[model samples]
Target: MPHPQAKIHRMFELVEPIATVTFSEVVNEAFLSLGMRNYWDGYFAGRAAPLGLAPAEVVHAVFYNFADGEVARHIPWVWGKVTPQEALAVRERASAVALRQQIGEVAESPGLVRVADLATRAAMSAPTEGRALYAGLKALDVPEDPVAKLWHAATLLREYRGDGHNAALVAHGIGGTEAHVLMALALGMQAETFGRIHHLPKAQLAAVVDGLRERGLVDAAGEFTDAGRETKQRIEALTDELAAPAYDVLIADELDELIAGLEPIAASISND
Candidate 1:
């Protein structure tokens, strides 16, 4: 059997888009599932003011902020005292701590030895994929304009699938939902795909597609227009530019060996 911690990591990886924004909620869910809710509540309460949040809002954000509205609803908790920027910073720091601790626990859990092993293998494989992606981007030609740069970066990031949300956030200044839309389109995914992969609803998916079209990022048939294609090419170029240095830093054989070691661990965790 996979360790419960492995299951927790899989859940975290799936919901990483919201991690910085909805840190408290993700941590609460993970800890609560492990029967550590009360312990966290007390710990957070003591750290709230220092973390720049009211205790209640911190707690609420951590567990209850599932969508946009939920986050908006809690705005009053720190209306005068905390700026939105500050709040995000607090959430990010707290979330990082929570995730690190969770991973540590998983690493220590005897039941998760197989899962941990798989995770090690996955990490090893990441470099090769990264290298291939970098090469693909370098092979593409994109203009040097700033607007073109933004578009290119967004498109290349979308190709990674794993990094698509980050690309979406950069391109649209909207988080998760918008990221999901861009990723889905880039991958030729449909409403059902979004539903299964990210648990998004049809209405939400429709809205995102519509928004992209309105912004001239995508077209009526959910295809990338000339502009969209240009944007994607630019993104790929940017990715290659950025990754080249890192690729040079690591030996290929080392990367492959690392991937071989980590693949099983990542697989075990996902399976769990």
Candidate 2:
């Protein structure tokens, strides 16, 4: 049996995107307090702030999979405006508002808290295993706001899974720009958001894209080639494979139902 935490991680994968997608409005609002004009700038800085009020380079190192050079341009500007704690507080406040919105819609939806309960069990059972990202997210003080508790559990699973995914990518000899390119292509990332969030220079991004093309992973138009598609799929499978063992605590049926139960919440928030 895989670790119970693995099942939790998989289940959370289904729930995590909704959290991020719905967070945009709340995130934009939170950045106002941090003096950031843009959401990406505020987001990266706010997120990495927990790692420390460190330099751009230092924060980049701690950030794991981001395209470093593109973001290196602005992190100093961001860190200069807010201390790590302040940045984190702003993030939590924004998350709290978003959480409230998400949960309230289901005020009458039966078993609203069920997903949170299941995720909490998985979080309680998962081990750290020297993953810094997981540890940092785990150390965050859980919000007592009833609605926020569900978001808190979902956040933990997302971070834990992300940290482990990076570890798996590294083990496969993927790193730096190539890793970012591979992920961006494999994950079906939106071109507009990718450019904005990664902030990679055109020349640098071009070079990586050119290299991926040379290796037959992408085509002239920058879409994934057949091989590229396969590579991306493999990476995701391996990521899930690496993350799977954590769910041994639940039976397959329970995991299935948990995913089913959360679909409506995701659907409800899909347009939000």
RMSD of each: 14.6, 3.5
Model 1: worst 10 consecutive residues (lDDT sum): 146-155
Number of the top lDDT candidate: 2
Per-residue lDDT of model 2, residues 1-272, tens digit only: 55454455456556685447425777777786567867767877766766675667766665666675645766777877877778777777677677567656673444766766665666545677856666776777776654565666666667667777777767765666677777666568733347433666678678777887888888988888898788767766677766664455567776776677677766666555
How do the residues 137-232 of candidate 1 rate in per-residue lDDT, one tens digit apiece? 334443233222222332233233333323434553444555455556567775346542355566866777688778787888877767665665
Off by over 4 Å in 1: 1-30, 33-70, 73-176, 191-193, 196-208, 223-253
